[model samples]
Target: MIELKSAGEISAMREAGRVVAGVHAAVRAQAAVGVSLRELDQVARTVIHEGGAGSSFLGYHPSFGATPYPGVICTSVNGVMLHGLPTPYRLRDGDLLSVDCAVHVDGWHADGTVSFVVGAARAEDLDLIRVADATLAAGIAAAVPGARMGDVGHAMSAVGRGAGYGMQNDFGGHGIGREMHESPFVPNEGRKGRGLWLRPGLVIAIEPSLIAGGGDDYHMASDGWSVCTGDGSRSAHVEHTVAITQDGPVILTVP
Candidate 1:
């Protein structure tokens, strides 16, 4: 069921959102060439610990997961779209990195993601990242009251298709609350004027992940966690936790 948060609940959620945003900011600044994904996870752990927040990803074992997720952050690089488990692999030049983090404060949860190039930025890499970012923003813009969930998906599709990029609907955003991955799945491509109606206090994660190639096919890595493009092309992902309100969409996980 889609639970509409109360005013008090929204306040608590904002606290969680603040921590999530701070963690993303810290990770973005600390990301650089030669840094290990494990090291980046440590940075996120420190931020969550210092802020007295709990990790929403750590120890999380979803139905699709093989084991309990052991990291506080997800470090998806290049072809990996999402759920790239942290490892000892170090970053290299021209690597497009996607960092996803979530935090819980006083029982409320917030999630966010950021994708950027580590050292040297390729023109195509920059374009992919930029388009993903803009696509996420457009998705958020569709979260206003009275808007259907399909409208959000439509906006996301327009951004990706307009850029000549294929949509990866295998994984997308979802409603989030006391637990992560709540009701009302949000896809990256869909028709408008369909699905659930948006209302005040409905919070959802609007994540737009895309590959620069021309197909939506993807493959799973041997690690049983990371997912990569089937064509081996680079991928980018951007996300923000947004809330529908009487005033419109409010970005809760802003950095």
Candidate 2:
């Protein structure tokens, strides 16, 4: 069921969002050439713990997951789209990396993702990341009180399509609060003026994932978690947890 958060609950979520943001900042700083994905995950774990929050990703066994997740953060490198397991794979210069992290504080949850190049970023990779950031911004802007969920998706997909990027509709954003995942699945693409109507206290994660090759097809990795582009093209993912409020849409997952 769709659960609207109270003002106090939203405040608690904001605190959790701050912890998630800290993890992103620390992971981004530690992500460099020669750094292993596991190292990055450890960085996130440390930050989450120091912030007095618990990881929502660690031990999380979603319905599709084969086992409980072992990492505090997801480190998707290059063509890997999402749910990339943190292994012993070391980073190399020019590698594109996307880090996804979620945390809970006082029972409220927040989730977000960031994509960037490790070192010596390629022009094309930078462009893809830019589009992903723009797409996320558009989606967050559309998430205002009185707007429909489709409006947010439409706003996000429009930016991706206009950039000639492909979107993965199979996996998208969703409501987040007491639990890391909640009701009202938020698609990356949708028609305007359709889907759930936005209202005050409604909080959801707005993530926009774009494939550079302009194809949506993807395949699962042998590890049973990592998702990669079928065409072997690079991808970028960016996200922010937003709350529809009486005044406007407020982004909860911000540093």
Candidate 3:
């Protein structure tokens, strides 16, 4: 069932979101050419620990997962779309990297993701990241009270489609509260007037992951965790945790 959060509960969740944002900030600052993915993960770990927040990704073994997740954050590089495991591989100039993170503070959870270039950036890669960021903003704008979930999805998908990008069919954002994953799976594409009605106190993560080659096909990596594009094309992912309130849609995951 979908659980509505109270004012106080939402406040607590904002705290968790702050920690998630901090992790993203630290990861972004530390990610560069010559940096190993494992080192970036450690940066996130330090931020989470110092914030007194627990990682939502570590030890998480979802039904589709082959084993418990071993990192505090997912490090997706270039063709790696999602669930990319951190490794000893050092980043190279012009590499596209996406970091996904989640955290819980005082039992409330928040999740978010960001994509960027390691050092030197290609024009196409910058364009891909721009579209992904735009889609995420569109999704958040559609999260106001009384709107339908499909409105949010439609808003996001329209941007990606217009940019000639494709999204993963099986993976998208989800309801987040005390648990990292909750009821009411949120899709990236849908009819504007369809799906669940958005009510005040409703909280959800809005993430848009776009494939530059305009294909939806992807395959798992040998590590049983990383998801890479089937066509070897690059991708970008961005996200935010938003809450619907009487005033408007409030983004909880901000630094």
Candidate 4:
């Protein structure tokens, strides 16, 4: 079932999204080299609590996973793609970290992800991160009413492929409202004219993931949480929660 929010409810979701974005910004600021991944998660926990919001990931257990998530935020480093459980591993120079977060405020949920380079970034690393960001932007641009879900996927895939990066389609975005993950799974790659039609008040997250080695295959990490590239290549992911409004797509996870 696709859930649509009212104008007033959408306003509240946007507010929740602002808090999530703020949390991401705070985590990024504290993610310097030598900082442990657990430290970053602590920053996220603090920001969410300080913002008077509940974490969408705390103790979250999905059918696909064996155990409930144990951290407040996901910390995917280099080879890891998604579902990276925050651990005591300390970051180092040139480590590419992707932080994924979601928060629930007043019964509404908003999710977003941001990728960052810890120290000096390699040339290709910079390109991979840029591609992920651009891919997310393209997907958001295609979130207008009258546009099919495939349009967003295709746009995101084009950005990744054009930059010579491998795109990951196993995990993508989804419709978000009262819950973090709702109905109507939104893939990162799709044909241009299929799937559910866009309507106002429908909020969703559009995430684009790319690997540096140009290989699309991935493997599940032994931790049973993180997903990494099969060839041990670095990866980057970018995401944003947006709503299809009368004024095109409104990026709720931004100011």
Candidate 5:
């Protein structure tokens, strides 16, 4: 069921959003060449702990995953698409790091993601990241009240397809509130005016996952969580949990 948040509940979720956003900001500052994904996870864990909030991601066991997740944050580097578990693998020059983070504060939750190049930015990688960011912005723009859910995906598709990039629909966005994943699945491509009707209080994570190649074909890693690109091409992802309101879409996961 699609549950709407009360005003007080929305306030609580904003707190969670800020906490997750802080984690992203801290991790962004610490990410650099030679830094291991494990080290970055530690950084996020420290922030989550000091903030007095529990991790919504830790021990999260979805039916598709082989086992419960073990990290506080996702560290998808380079060819890895998403759900990349933190590991001893160190970031190298020109590596594109995609970090997905979530946090729960006072029983509410917020989620967000960011992608960036560590040391030297390759032209192609930079382009893909830029497109993903723009795609996310477009998706957010299409989240106004009364807009069809498919409009959001259609907007995102315009950006990715315009850049000749491949869009990933297998792992798309979803309604987020008490849990990390919820109802009203939001795909990356769809016909406008074709999906659920947008209404006030409906909060959903609008994530744009794009690949550099022609297809978003990917496979899970041995870790049972890491999903990587099948063609070994670099990818980028950007997300923000947004809420439909009488005025417009309100982005919760912002610092």
Candidate 6:
């Protein structure tokens, strides 16, 4: 069911989001060539605990997964799209890394992610990351009170389409609060003025994922978590937890 959060409750969620943001920042700083994904996960864990927040992602067992998530943060490298499990593999120069994270504080939850190149960044890879970031910003801008959910998706997808990029509708953002995942599924692509109506007190995560080449095609890895481009092309994912209020779309997870 869709839920609305009070101002005080939103403040609490913001706190959790701040912690998630700190984890993202700390992990981003730790990520570099020769760094293992597990090391980045360790950095996130340390920051989450130091902030006095509990990881909402650890041991998370989604309906589609047979095993619980083992990492505090998802470290997706290169062509790996989403849910890329951290492993011993060391990041190489020019590797595009996407990290997704969530944490709870004062009974509220917040989730966010970032994609960055390890050392030297390729022009196309950099552009893909820029698309993800810009699309997320546009999506958040449409998350105002009284707006339809479709506005957010349209705003996001339009950016992708205009840039000649492909969007993945199969997996997208969703409502987030006391739990990691909630209701009112937010797609990265959709028709304008359609879907659920937005309102005050509503909180949701706005994530836009795009593939370098155009299309909705994607493939799930054997790990049952990691997803990537079907054509083996590069991809990028960007996200933020936003709150719809009278003031506007408040991005709670900014670092």
Tell me the TM-score of each prediction against the true structure: 0.98, 0.99, 0.98, 0.98, 0.98, 0.98
Candidate 2 has an lDDT of: 0.92
lDDT (tens digit, per residue) of candidate 6 on 49-105:
999999998999997765899999998887788899988889999999999999999
lDDT value, candidate 6, whole model: 0.90
lDDT of 6 at 185: 93
Clash number by candidate, in order: 0, 0, 0, 0, 0, 0
Give, for candidate 4, the lowest lDDT window spanning 10 residues. Answer: 63-72
CA error at residue 22 for candidate 6, angstroms: 0.5
Off by over 4 Å in 4: none
**Cα lDDT tens digits for candidate 1, 86-192:** 99999999899999999999888999998989988999999888888889888988888998999999999998889998778869899998987898798888789
For residues 90-151, could you state the per-residue lDDT of candidate 5 as single tens digits?
99988999999999987788999999999989898888999999999999999988889999
Query: Runs in model 6 with CA error above 4 Å?
Result: none
Tens-digit lDDT track of model 3 for 71-108: 99999999999999989989999999999999999899
Candidate 2, pairs of clashing residues: none
Task: Kindly report which residue stretches of model 3 are placed more than 4 angstroms away from their true locations once superposed.
Answer: none
Question: What TM-score does candidate 1 reach?
Answer: 0.98
Model 5 TM: 0.98
All-Cα superposition RMSD per candidate: 0.9, 0.7, 0.8, 0.9, 0.9, 0.9
Candidate 5 segments exceeding 4 Å error: none
Candidate 3 local Cα displacement, residue 225, angstroms = 1.2
What's the true lDDT of residue 178 in model 5? 88
User: Residue by residue across 56-169, what tens digits does model 2's lDDT show?
Assistant: 999999877878999999999999999999999999999999999999998899999999999899999999999999999999888888889899889989999999999998
